[model samples]
Target: MEYILAKYNYWIYILLMMIGLYAMIAKNNLVKKVIGMSIFQTAIIVFYVSIGAKRGASIPIIAHGHGHDVIATAVSAAEYANPLPHVLMLTAIVVSVGTLGVALAVCLAIYRRYNSLEEDEILEQLR
Candidate 1:
């Protein structure tokens, strides 16, 4: 049961990624595309967080008012979660938000120009 839970989470993330990617590529509406992109980005974040998470580990950090090196000194090595992946995840989250914003803005521009959100309709209008 424990192995199943662990494996299932990974599979769920993979399935979400594939679904989001398919929606992004196969959908006809610009808004739908943006939604798909967001889905895809979120799946990636889930994957990252899952990779960093251990079943019993506590988040890595010194307790309040404790110095940076204090936790390292006080806690046993086995208790703390890895900090590196969490930091990388934070950066990735910011980038994903930026990308999503830009994608939505572009979708809005398309809607304004064509007065429709469908990709096929926009292409038809262009041609």
Candidate 2:
């Protein structure tokens, strides 16, 4: 029970990822596939952000006082949340947005060319 409480967020994210994977694999419509891809991307982003979270931690900022001669104190790593994952996730989010835009544009072109968004229909038109 304690383990479950501690790791529930991971489990939820995994469930979301599975749902997205299933939709991408089993759905008939191109739009549904795109939606599933977006969901998968979102799950990844959330997972990364959650990984960076620290209990009883503060933001990664330094506080300054009005004394230049004051002795510098060592900062503990555990007192601050990890910023690397957050930064990487920001970049990932931008890339995911661009990818989704390109995918939707391609879907639009496919729909215009074949007059259908279903994979079977598109394949039939190709053949």
lDDT of 1 by residue, 1-127 (tens): 8887758868898899999999999999887888888889888888888888776788786446365655455556567777777899899889988998888888888878899999888889989
Q: List ranges where model 2 is wrong by over 4 Å.
A: 63-73
Worst 10 residues of 1 by lDDT: 62-71
Per-model TM values vs. the true structure: 0.84, 0.86
Q: Please give the lDDT score at residue 39 for candidate 2.
A: 93
Q: In TM-score terms, which candidate is top?
A: 2
Candidate 2 per-residue C-alpha lDDT over 13-53 given as tens digits, one digit per residue, 9 for 90 to 100: 99989999999999999999999999999899889988999
Please give the distance, in angstroms, between residue 49's alpha carbon in candidate 2 and its true position after superposition: 1.5
List of clashing residue pairs for candidate 1: none
Decoy 1 TM-score against native: 0.84
RMSD of each: 2.5, 2.5
